[model samples]
Target: MKLHEKPLIRYATSKTPVDKEGHLYKKGERNTSYQKRWFILKGNLLFYYDKRSDREPLGVIVLEGCSVQLCESNENYAFDIRYEGPGIRTYKLAAEDQRTQEAWVKALLWANFSRLRMLVQDLERTYEQVRVDSGPRHRLTVLGIESEQVTTHLGRPVHGRAATHRPAPSTFTSEPLENFVELHERYRKEVDAVRQEWLSKRNQQHGDPPVADLVDLN
Candidate 1:
């Protein structure tokens, strides 16, 4: 049995945010000829249209669990969207140029939720650690708190430019020194642990010969 595109039709204008939208030549499954189509990539979905002004997609491809790869074909800048499962046909597409091909391939790979979710998780963890390490005062300074007020006060007309207004004494209680001590200790431990792990792996890969491997006949 041969695959057909009739079953792939999901006729509706997608309201999802589009990651990439461009024209690409798609290889016809039946005709084996390349056809110019307007391609729109939303999250985990690749929708194509016969015309760019078309209100609905001609077909929608669920990109989940599928792999996009550059392939050698008669067409230039050809790539394949392959899935190792039944009933789903591999989509072959080609871009106008090498730059467009690379861009489309990268966009398609990043179109999946799994890839975006991992990226979001990594960013969250990294920013969360930065938040934890920074003090409240430091965070407030970063947010420009009290900066405008200070600037306004300083910019006011004074007796002389050399005799600017002196800032009032700070009434806020200083953060505990113990907190800094604890923070330093925690960071030191984490760094030491990471260094040790790296050294262990390095030694396993390129350490000196073992005692058992060394022998003296003398």
Candidate 2:
């Protein structure tokens, strides 16, 4: 199946929620600065609403090219999601408690990773679509996937914002083995960094000892 032809399997949800929580922000005068909302993580999009069955979503946050960082303590379980994509945005949100906040962060990271892996798989699938091949090896690759480019460093979108991004133009190249090898090394380091971060967080959640310093990624 083509990239867009595949089913949308992005799913994220916060297990804990505060009743009728409102995202604190300002509007015009004579209007209440806050509105009641239900924040939810579903698929690759983090959206919220007055209710689950509501026809229109208050906002949608794309998981691609996004990153999430848990915030310091606040009255609301405050945290931030930063998006580095074309429609760049940083979202500030708070939940009822720490559990809810942690859940949100984990869900966001998982969804973002899923999106990144999908892109990688799509690139591998595109190997058959290549019109050019690299030197004698006859290799075709763009992501051949050097790791830095595939990080799940997603961005955040505001609750009241609409999706305003267009697909980026393709930049595939049929580079030689040396280029691919260099890319592999670079991406390998980046992937290791991300893997370490994930492992640290995962260990903390599992109440387990730290992983060994040396890892055989192969």
Top candidate, metric TM-score: 1
lDDT of 1 by residue, 1-218 (tens): 12145543432363556788999999988889999999988777788888999876777777765666666777887777877778878898888887787677667755543433443334334433544443232221211323223223223221211111121211111122113234334434443444444445556789844323121211
How far is each candidate from the true structure, as Cα RMSD in Å?
21.8, 18.7
| TM-score attained by model 2 | 0.44
Whole-model Cα lDDT per candidate? 0.56, 0.45
The most accurate candidate by lDDT is 1
Per-residue lDDT of 79-162 in model 2, one digit per residue for the tens?
556754576556655555555555565666666655555655444333323312212333332345332343322222212111
Q: TM-score per candidate, in order?
A: 0.48, 0.44
